[model samples]
Target: MSAHSVPAPLPCPAAIRLHCAGPLEAVVVAALQRACFPEDPWDDASVATLTAPPTGFAVIALDGQEQPVGFAMARVTAEDAEILAIGVLPQARRGGIGRCLVEAVAAGSHGRGATALFLEVAEDNQEAWTLYKVCGFFSVGRRPGYYRRRDGRVAALVLRRNLDGA
Candidate 1:
């Protein structure tokens, strides 16, 4: 498959598996960050620290080869769960990887007793906004200058999803 083209579905029933990330998955997680966000990418150390446990949860979705195609990370507090970051590799885009990752993260958060989930997205990223909406997120607010774009513009949008029904 081309670098930017989504591959055909794997012969094995495509399953999005979630796991409690650890040091071993740092490299793949870092790669996913880089592919998803060209403006900024998480380093291996950051990935390891975030996945360390207690404070956060890092989950990954793998292809048939066990390659990390997407991932989602979130931090849970007493009252709410904040989705820290989520992205799918460029080659895996539009193949339901992002949705799978979000579902996994939401499930994990709900299991931990979190009632609501929140996240911020770049204002211009309509694709992400659409996905979040489909996943039951609603625009609650916006943060001025939340993200700096490559063209030197700053924009932001706040979205929240209620996990009560999930």
Candidate 2:
């Protein structure tokens, strides 16, 4: 992929608008994050700090009504970028919002001179794992017992996607 391109196979749905969230929008993004991942919520202040500027940035997905529905936070360092967090509301799942957020982050990271984008997903999260795979990400590593589940713990699959045509 080039810096100006989003993954060709995954396009943003017409009804959804993707906005690059500034620091001022951290609170709203935090709320959406909480709604999407009630089990692991980041406070507004933390969200703000994580997505401040320069190496850090966020992309928010809005519905046609202009309501925040999903978000992706990422940071670029050297030639690599990592997705700090990403989620879409339960009501908005399976509608291509998550894929849009991933592509947005990937494009943003590429713009910032990143060669690869990385993220970790719980091994048991088939939905997200499948999405990443479809987005052209491949598992490069794994961390055992990385996620605390209600039943026990699950491993985290560390996935990566090349962004600079590397």
Candidate 3:
């Protein structure tokens, strides 16, 4: 995609707004992140710290009412980028918000000179795994017991995709 090209919108039942979150939206994005990943959410301080770095950026998805329903954050360095976190509220699941957020990241990363993007997802998160696959990411590695949970440790699958034509 060209540096100024608009990110493609995901097909879904409801309309969703996607935008790059700035320093002013840090607190709101942190709250949305916590709502989506209650198991291990980043604190407001962490969100502020991550989003302020030169290499870091955030994408937030909002519903019709302008409420945050999902968010994705990533860091890019030179020709590579890594998705740090992405989450959609339970109420917004399967509505295409998550996919849109991912696309936003991919487009933004491509614009920043990143040739590829990587992300690690909990092994048991079938929905997310499927989403990534549909979005062109392929599994490249796995880390055992990477996520600590109340029941037991869950593995994390690393996925990567080239953004040559994103």
Candidate 4:
């Protein structure tokens, strides 16, 4: 792949396995989170919380070589769920990995009895906004200056979607 090439954005959910993330994956998940969210990242403990079995759920996407490429984490409580974090390496994006990670989270959460999913995204992050919208999320509210950046604060757009269809 060239430095400037963005692979065709095609849904290849079948080719990837959404493995349940566990304690063993914490090290990798933490690194991916930090690389993807330099401004605000989660630690190893936070990533390991997903393996607690009752409240949180996480999935790691691995390529054909069994290398981690992306992940999604969420919290589920009965009929409600909230996304905590998600990321795909810069080189692996535009290949629908992010979207698949989200779908995996939704499907897994729904299987665990969650019907609605909630999340917040920085308003200025158009890439994430577009991804959420495409995944069936809609803006339900906004928190002004909710995210702090080195330069300034950014608003957080609260997004929600029904996972019943996923």
Question: Largest TM-score belongs to which candidate?
Answer: 2
* Model 4 lDDT per residue over 132-160, tens place: 99989999999999999889999999999
Candidate 1 residue-wise lDDT, 1-166, digit = tens: 3232222222212664445576577877788888888788889888887766676777777777767778788888875998888998887789787876777777778778889999999888999999999888999998888787767866778889998875
| Per-prediction TM-score to the true structure, in the order listed | 0.85, 0.93, 0.90, 0.87
What's the CA error at residue 42 for candidate 1, in Å? Answer: 1.6
How close to the true structure is residue 90 of candidate 2, measured as C-alpha lDDT?
A: 93
- Candidate 2 residue lDDT tens string, 28-142: 9899889988888899999999998888999888799988888899999989999999999998999999989998898889889999999999999999999999999999999
Which of 1 and 4 is ahead in TM-score? 4
- Show the lowest summed lDDT stretch of 10 residues, model 1: 4-13
Alpha-carbon shift of residue 154 in model 4 (angstroms): 0.3
lDDT of 2 at 111: 84
**Model 1 alpha-carbon drift over 4 Å, by segment:** 1-16
Error of 3 at 89 (Å): 0.7
| Candidate maximizing lDDT | 2
| Model 3: how far residue 51 lies from native, Å | 1.2
| Candidate 1: Cα lDDT at 136 | 86
